[model samples]
Target: MASGASTKEPAAAPAATAVPDPKMPPPEKPADVRRRSYVILSFWLIVLLLGLPIWWMTTTIYRANLPLDGMIDWADGKACRPVFPLQISIQADALQPQEAQHLVRLIQHAIDDLNDFSGHHLRLQLAPKDDRRIVQKDNPELALTVRLKAGEATTASLDPHSAALDITYPSNAIPSPTSTSSPLATYIANELRSTFSEEQSIISYLLSTSSMSSDVRPQSLTPTDLAELDKRMTRSLRYAATYHLTFSLFADGSTPNTWDIEEAVEKYMRPLLDVLSPIHNFTVDTQLQLYATPGVQSQVLHKEDLASFINAAEWPLSPSIGGAPTVNFVIFAGNQTIALGDSESSAETSQSWLIPQWGTVYLLSLPDATSHVSSNILRQPMLTFGGHLLTLLGTPQAGSLPLRLSALTRIRSADLLLRSSSTLGSLARLSRSLPSISIPRTVADGVATSMYHLERACSNLGGLEGLMHARIAEEEAERAFFEKSMVGQLYFPDEHKVAVYLPLLGPVGVPLVLGLIKELKQWSKKRKEKAKEAREKKQQ
Candidate 1:
């Protein structure tokens, strides 16, 4: 029994000896603890002083300041008011200088009383008695010249060729020096007002269509006049500095594909193009299309069919590669005739039809054997095209080519000015509506440039320089309004930014936070010990 107990005790001792008591680590030295503290503090300082700033700088987005108030003012049509001053010269070769001057004063008063629009004013001046010409050849700015002649009954007629009104008045109908009102003077005033009535309506229409105040709007437009004006405005193309005019000859078969368009354009259209060069530039290009089909298959096209005659899908009438608009003039060699019966369709009884804002299409009936067209065959077509081009350009129908071109400059300038103002207003409203959209420096610069040009354009209205300045303003406004960088930032939100930054910052931040906490605990322990020692010393 003793031997068995000894053996069991030895086994228990071996088992207890198999696992020794756990070893304990020695307390850290002061130098090593200080070193650890310094390392942790240095890392925190680096992160706080350098790393934080660098990360903030890299992650931040730059937003440039814009002129919101000024842009809004321009867009609201509150910044500039347009005015047109028309100068009329009265030439009374048959009367004395004093008499003509007196008549002019009376007529001016009558015109002023009849005028309703403040923006358009008419100033009358007496032409020199020595000048026999109806219109002052030296003064191109004269809107009209009145020529007085002695005749049977009081009559006034506008010269067909010049901007002159011929008035045949009886010798007894002349205004006396002391007479406050005369039949001759009243008649002349009425005639002058009648002559400018269309112009006034047109100008008033422009102002009303813009963002200007309604107080100055004219209410004299009849329903018929409004309908006509709407049709004309809708038919006219948008104002552009340049237009691409493409003359294409299309045929159902291969015959009569090519035409002598280049020569015809130079002979018939070159003079008009040169006259319009100051207002707009036109680029000419010609192409021959074979085996092309019209949009309508009817042999006899009705008045309603004219609208859908052109095949827009298959036709290569894309806008010019540059920023200019395209005007396509097509000549189709087909035997289609226009069905003409109603009086309403009489205006389109000819073989050609005008496509508003686009070009014209003339159906030229030719023999099946005809291949290449000569310049003579294209003469009438070119002439018709020239007239249609003027209409497409928004030229007044009543004026001569030169006069129409001058009117076109003023019209284009006003139109572009209004368009730019409207665009600026749109942009201002967009910015205000979307506060989160990031505006870059380029957009701000563009807005500044646009406003500068707009001010210049407003001051120089009714001149070639005004048109050029308005064009620049329009381009800049478009660029700033459609800025890509500003639009891109609107789609991304703050959550996306956090999702991208959290993974990278989390891994690096945990160890730093743990080290800082450990250092703070050590510092607290040392401070308590030092305070306890100082209190004990004081007690002793």
Candidate 2:
């Protein structure tokens, strides 16, 4: 019965019967296929015309219009030529007006003949005989005043206290109105030239250091002069409109920590600070630091060891929290002596050394038991610091503090002008060299501001206005060259860009490729069908 039932079940299972395949609705109609193609084409057209442009506009960086040619011209020194017209007033109260005027003409001619540098020239003007003393006070542009006096021999001496050149000439040395030249005239010209030689050298050095061609540079600088200029330049601090003067008393031990710094500064340094007010604004602060250690472990500090004795890493010599630069004047209480090798023995030598562009350090040897420093003890140190300050500020070593400060203003203006121009040139070159680097609108704005200020500063070269403009130009140029956005572009590469864009592009690109392939297949099919219809007609 079981075998019969299995046989019946096998028989119920149909042999060689094919299940019908599921029928497709039908081959798509030509119209329907064309409509589907149109839909895909429309989708891609929307993506290409609308989506791509929107994405590019939204993601791109903003770059402002820049005066590239103008900036390059300024940087190359083709736009402006710097000229210094120095006005000198001659005071000859001892002589008649006509005679003084004659002497002045002759001296002026002699000076003109002697001057080789066209950029810097001296012009002579007669001082008002009615009020000789008021000449400098009245004319702020007067660079020097020559006072004539009758004496035994023709001689010239610079006033220690004023910017006056005192000339003591013999009675016969005075040039007559008819004379074209005289010993007195030549002597005055030569003396004036000698007085300004150092200044001329400095200006020449500055011009040489700039981007200007050799045509504008003075060719008279000897190797020694250049070396001296380099030394002075390296020793000086960068120009700043404001400086923070920090007076610090550092002691290895707790004793001798208290100092009369305020009194000392008021008595000794105030006059200089007041004179320097026009060129730089200085803020003074005092501090007392105890248990300070020197960087060098040597008991006796040598000349070479002085450089590393400041303990810059450990010392509280941070720059002030404003735009101004800091100049530290440290007075350390220690027994460390600077040994002068192979020099004649002296009971006392210089107890101070100046750090270039930094400040002065005075090693004071005081009694170990002493706990205070008096103003009297600080007098010499204060004087030393004042002198060092002048050096650090690029003050002329030959002139009085007043004259040096005036020169400093002019020097700083020149420095800033060159610096701005050089920065602009560097930026231009960098832009041309780096095609991928992005320039922001802020950089363009800063460049424009710098150029504007540079123009103003160039127009008014030796005045306070020039200094102000130059300072602004330097700051703007620096800001533009160091734009944060510009630097950020360097970290983003092409691969990074591809990675960032791939996610959005992948889905859209796939649909586009598929639609294109479908359209090509339809076109081929239409061509084959048309060929087949032509063949059929021919056969019929």
Candidate 3:
């Protein structure tokens, strides 16, 4: 080789194979082999018996036991049947006790013959002979008082100021105790029926819409009647303990931004609210938005165009954050009038339109220079709004204020009972359908409370006491159904579990499996050796 010649280093020698030593260390002692086996077995035992169980216990979700069957019963209408017993009083101081009793019995029979619905029944009781009271305005227990007076002819008229029906009959029209039927009895029955026809129809409609399919339906009600009632029912707002009345004035220009809203509300609206206080609590708020525009920009808004009349995007009519539902009353200061495709005079006369389940929109034409709206100018608007408020509350159009409010209690209670039951049914279905979801103890407690209150409400359905229970039940049922924890669990999918465990399992699993396999092979080899030695010893 030349002195300065560069040469490549020899390729790395292949690694030498390790040879078994002929003089191996004495075979591993039995104690050591057993110790080795025990070590692997203890690791596996720790993983299988201790670690896995602890992990499972820690990861498992707690689900409280719910009264699924009872909830379902309420939902299906098997738990409670609603019945409203209306009390009617007969006022007849002019007649003898026997004649009054006979007339009362005959009138009840007439009413019974004309009525097929059993859920709503009118029980008539004779007023005290000395009781000269004509109107029972505060007594919700007495639905109506029929004042009978001897007159030239049988004529009936409802007292506009109170819950009294004045009926006059000829002296010969009085029925004797032995009389089976009389024209006078029939006339009073027809008149009473006509007076209460709207209420009965409303109550019957409520019962029919309930989940409990009752045998006592309004067989006498025609489809048109049902359709009209349905419309009213849909237009009404859902009952709440309180209602937020948001009065907003959307002014196209800065003019009319300031109004005598406080004065107008206190004077015109406060009295009506006081009347409604027993059933619903009211909270009032007034706001003025200047340079606001309506969604419809036209001189005459068609009926179809009225739907989008509220400028939701620009209008600050967001509902109150309080739990009570909000009712929006917006007055737009514009010359735009609603077009109902009616006569010009009728169209011009119309000042407002009601938005179903919402509130009302009143159009007021004002000059741009007018800086303020007086309480006098607000009188008609306030009155109109008050009337619309009652309609939105589902008040019957046929009865006096007291009787209508009384009926409202019954209607609201029934409505709450059904709503709570439906919510419970939904929750029960959710629990059954979603096994992985967790139900906290609060949910269980709420469900139990709701069912208990539901029972109480069902027992006292026709009274105001039932309304209290129904409200509580509705609140509890809604709270339980909307439990936040149950909703949170839906996001933890199965894929997340694999991603969490795979890193720890992959590295640790391989060593454990290999050690187990090697131990098994050694055991098999030793067994073979012992068997061969046994055969050799026997042959020798």
lDDT against the true structure, per candidate, is 0.81, 0.84, 0.86
Report the candidate with higher TM-score, 1 versus 2. 2
Ranking by lDDT: 3, 2, 1
Taking all chains together, the TM-score of candidate 3 against the true structure is 0.84
Please give the distance, in angstroms, between residue 39's alpha carbon in candidate 3 and its true position after superposition.
2.0
The TM-score of predicted model 2 comes to 0.88
Q: RMSD, each candidate, Å?
A: 5.4, 6.5, 7.9
Worst 10 residues of 1 by lDDT: 8-17
Worst 10 residues of 3 by lDDT: 131-140
User: What digit string (tens of lDDT, one per residue) describes model 1 on residues 220-260?
Assistant: 77889888988998998888888999998989998996688
- The most accurate candidate by lDDT is 3
The collision pairs in model 1 are: none
Error of 1 at 400 (Å): 3.1
Q: What digit string (tens of lDDT, one per residue) describes model 3 on residues 1-540? A: 899999999899899999997886888999999999999999899999999999899989999999998888888777877666777888898899999999999999999998766767788888876544543443445767899999999999988767778999999999877899989988988887787777777877876776645444654678999899999999999888899998888889878768999999999999999989988999999999999988988778877788888889999995865888888888888898886766544545466999998999999888769889999988888898999999999998876787677778888887888889889988988889889899999999999999999999988877788899999999999999999988898678889989999998889999999999999999999999999999999999
- lDDT for residue 143 in candidate 2, whole number 0-100: 72
User: Which stretches of candidate 1 lie above 4 Å from their native place?
Assistant: 1-37, 130-140, 179-186, 212-227, 312-319, 341-348, 432-436, 513-540
- Number of the top candidate by TM-score? 2
Clashes per model (N, Cα, C within 3 A): 0, 0, 0
